[model samples]
Target: MKRRTKKLLLNWRIILLTVFLIGSVVTLAVRPLTFGIDISGGVALVAQTEHPVDADTMQLVVDSLQKRLNTLGLRDITVEAQGDQIVLVKVANVTTAEEADAIKNVIESQGVFYMEFDGVIFGTGQDVEYVGIYQIKPDNTWSVPFRISKSAAEKFAELAKGKTGWPVDMFLDPPVNSLLVVPDSVYNLMNSSEFNAQVPEAPTLLQRITKAFNITVVAYANQTADELADMAEGREKIVLVDLNQGLQSELENMNVTVRLVQRGPGESDHALIIRTLGLYGPYSVGEGLATGQPQQDVQITGTASDRLTAEQEARQIYTVLKSGSLPVKLNVVGMEFISPRLGENFKYQALLAGIGALIAVFAIVYFHYRNWKIAIPVASTSFFEAIIILGFAALIQWNLDLPSIAGIIAAIGTGVDQQIVITDELLGGTKETRITRRSNVLKRMGRAFFVIFASAATTIVAMSFLLIYFVGTLKGFAFTTILGVVIGILVTRPAYAEIAKYLLGED
Candidate 1:
């Protein structure tokens, strides 16, 4: 027995498993696996397009959203399209309700950018060729430099010829065929001198905006449903600024698409204009740009009160502009926030489920074999397989969610079943046959491996489809399941065969 034990420890198959076990531990320590929103608490948003799209268009949508989030330095995020219309956006480590809202806004931002001078469109997101990193200006404002296509540059130069000091309007995802509804107070502010400082030509800013954007305007003043309906007749929707809840609900009852925006305290006039009119800036055309030189480079500048805010604003702009525009707009259908406490509870529950699965498998195996030797090996191998799977996740930094935990359990159960097949093959035959087959351990294990390989292949194939075609949430489950199976086939199952051979004195 001592000789067999010594030989088993020295066996290369056993050593392979031992090396992986140690390596998995060390790798996990170096780079731990990141838990998903289900475990770490974050935001989950469901968005849908107005109409279903083709596979390529859906892929473009996913890529665009992914770029925006990643550019903002969000490391653990998933943006994937389900079917041809719905998209799931998930971000880990977002704990606050406010942060969730901010994420929704970012995801829904179509990133459509355009600039026009004197109501003549000159540039769009398609015109952008390259966007450089943002840098702080001497005036303590952030400026993002970008390059436009030569054709767009030339068009702008020709349009702005001999026309310096004129305002060039910049807009992002501006509404079309829409109406801007402001409260009486906000409408008065739009005409105020203080508001004029932020949005020059303020007294007539609304009319200029109405002309530039071709959007209708109306002010709320105890208007009846019919009056509101008349104003909304030719519009696709109504965008209200600082409007009361009563108006919003009434409009909803009228079957009108309405978007309500709350005006922030001391928000500048342009800010409100950007919200209601989609007009962010009225930047002045420079002499150099108006000289018809066909300048290809331009800068879009913004100022914030503090350095941190300036940096944040710069990154926000950079992220949007760099992502370009989505092929279709996504309307947020649902937003869910998972709290940290709930996340902790979920983690605890996942731990319990994994432990329960281990115990259940061990109990069933022990009853079937009536031997601790066989049952213990099965359980330990299953446990080791889990560690290897986790190590894979850590290496790739895959986010583990509840579905991923379920996949691990499923994989371990499959491991137990395959081990049983090997054990049954070894325990078969009469005394003479058993004696004769002692030297045939490799052949018996090989026979059992045939069945194991078939099953593993089948599971991996199914999960591969899920990984490629499914949404963000299901991808985690598919990935972990595939990882578990691969690890078992390559690492744990072979070692378990060696242990089984040793236990039966086949060595």
Candidate 2:
């Protein structure tokens, strides 16, 4: 036993698992498992591009969506790219179907950016080549510079050759072929002075929205369901402020997309426009830029009350300019909402179920072995397998849903079966002696390892397909399952082999 303990300690396989176990414990302590909507309660959305995109473009899509929401003061969201064309978004603390619908609209509305000079389209998002770093002056003013393509710059110069000091308007993610339906109260608020005061030198809110954006703003009270539904005949989307079941049903029957926009107290007209229309600025054409010089460099300048505000302003514009120029568009492929109360109940049930499964595993393994040394090691290996799998998830911040938990259990069960193989191989049945020859024991361990590797490879291959082809909950399942199989093959199985060999009275 003393010699066997030394051999076990000196084993390279044992050392590998021990190191991983310690690292996994540290990882868990630092970053715990991030639970999915099914467990922690929120919204899960899958958005897919119209056509497949490269890895870089897919990442840009994710970043663009994240920044767009962050600009709207939504920070508790995760955007992840799946495959080459799909994106997964998880938003926390969302409970209502209305909020989910609003979010879905926002993600789907990434549109082309256009800069117009006197109502003529001079440049679009396609013209932008690069966005420079944001700069802050000694004062609390910030600027974000960008460069356009040579052709686009030349075209802009021709459009504004002598039109100095003109307001060259910038519009991003504009609502094309869309309508806004609002109640009398909200419509009156939009017509108020405070609302129009948000935009400098701009006309009335109603006039500017109608003229500049071509969006028909109709008071729902003024139009009957038949009239509204007829008006929406050629429209792509209808943004409704207050919920009206009759109009919604009519529009739905027409196969039109109707989205809800919540009206909050103290909502400014400019903010409402930004939310509904995505207009950015009315940048003044300087003498230099408007002199027909074909200039490529341009900057967006603004003043903020403090350094923090200035930084925020500059960063937001920088992020938008960098990411919003991507030409691809995403459509909502799937959506799921889990209420907080239901998620909590599911979480408790998962915990209880995991514990019960673990207990049963130990009992079955102990009954089969009838040896404390073998049984203890087998059960402990399964337990450690779970910890290490969770640790990997925590390290990368993977969201664990029901499917992920099931994958973990399946991996652990496979681990126990493999461990039993190693034990039986070492013992060589009842006909064999306790102290088998060293060379024979080595051969048996090699065979056991080969079997373990083969099993793990098959599992990993099947899971890799699922991980690449699927999005949302299934990705979580594939990821955790693959990680478990890999850890078992590389760390736990070989380590268990070493321990079992030592226990069989081999040096």
Candidate 3:
């Protein structure tokens, strides 16, 4: 018995399982698995492309969006293509409206940049070489310098020859309104007097922007402009046209805008037209700055009330300018926010479900076998299999969403079934076939593994399809399931067979 125990302990299968078990525990202790939005409480948005795109193009868009989100330091984000035209984005740990909006902008930008004069395109965002902070006469206001291509510069010069001081509008994804969509950090930076001093031509730079939105204030004696040129953007222009002059000035002091108006809100149809920005109208530039033939250098300026605000605003704009644009235009069709507290509740529930599954599987297996020797090892292997799967996920930094939790449960079920097959093959033979030689036991175990291997292979194949073809939230489920099966077959199952053989040999 002592020799047998020593041999079993020294078995290669046992040694491998032991190593993985230890490593799994250590990994869990050191770097725990990262939770997804469903578990950590964040936001999930579904966007539909403005026009239909092929699957490959959709995939490219998704990949590009993922890259953009990562640059924002948001590591826990999933950008997947759903069908051919819908994109799904999940951002973990973002609870604020401001954060959600920032992500939305990154996902929806069509990236079709253009600079036009009097409705004629002369340049696009592509013409701009770089967008960065420009120290124009330091200690005064700062400006954002856009270095354009020589061709763009010459074209602008030619256009400006006769139309000097005429508005030369710069646009992103032309025909879309330009409202200077900036992040909160950047909006604060542009409010500074120092920054505004440098770009004196941009009168609308310091307008009160709340949560990266345009807020236009009108005097107490209410009336709307003949046509707020920049009103033709993504959605209807939401102007604060009812406020008094004093409040308007206060908001402007904080870098907000309050202007005088002479007409009422205008016709209802006009309101709808502004909502869609004519769907395909030339986008109006804010504060319509006049341009000289800027020889490859263009400065954009905005006012920030303080220094930190100016810096943050500049950083935000810099990121937008640096990142590549989206391929197709998209509109936010759905958005849902999950609070952290609710996510915490989900974590607890998942834990309880997993524990309950383990207990239930063990009870059933023990009752079926009526032997601790067989039941204990089988149950132990199942438990260790889960740890291995979780460890792998953590090591890879995979986000643990609700679907992933469900996958873990499915894998546990399959593992228990496989273990039962192994035990039955080893112990249920008749006297003529049972109490056999070590060679015979090896043959029986091989037969059991054959069945296990086939089942595992089929499962993996099915999951592969889901992972490849269905690439949205379902990906989490398929990924965890495959990981569980591979670990079970390669790592845990072999160890279980070895332990069963040792115990059965003794009997």
| Winning model by TM-score | 1
CA error at residue 413 for candidate 3, angstroms: 1.2
* Superior by lDDT: candidate 1 or candidate 2: 1
36-76, model 3: which lDDT tens digit per residue?
98889999999998889986567657755664555343557
lDDT of each: 0.77, 0.76, 0.65
Say which prediction, candidate 2 or candidate 3, comes out ahead on lDDT.
Answer: 2
Question: Which stretches of candidate 2 lie above 4 Å from their native place?
Answer: 45-67, 70-89, 96-102, 111-336, 430-435
Cα lDDT tens digits, model 1, 97-151, are: 8667767887777776777665566788898888888998666699989898998
- Tell me the lDDT of candidate 1: 0.77
Off by over 4 Å in 1: 112-151, 155-323, 429-438
What are the per-model numbers of colliding residue pairs?
Answer: 0, 0, 26
TM-score for every candidate vs. truth?
A: 0.62, 0.58, 0.61
Candidate 2 lDDT, 1-507, residue by residue in tens: 676688779888888899899999999997767787777788989999999998767866886787566444342578888788888888876788977887898799875677766556677877889888899988999899999888878888998787766556666666656688877765775555433323344344555556656667777765766677677677777777655556666766777787655443356645665565555655667778767889898888889999999998887677667665766888999998878899889888988887887788778877876777788888888889999998888887777889999899888888988898888878775425464588888887888889888988899999999898766667778887888889998899888877776665654
Worst 10 residues of 1 by lDDT: 194-203
After the best TM-score superposition of candidate 1, give how far the Cα of residue 371 lies from its true spot, in angstroms. 1.3
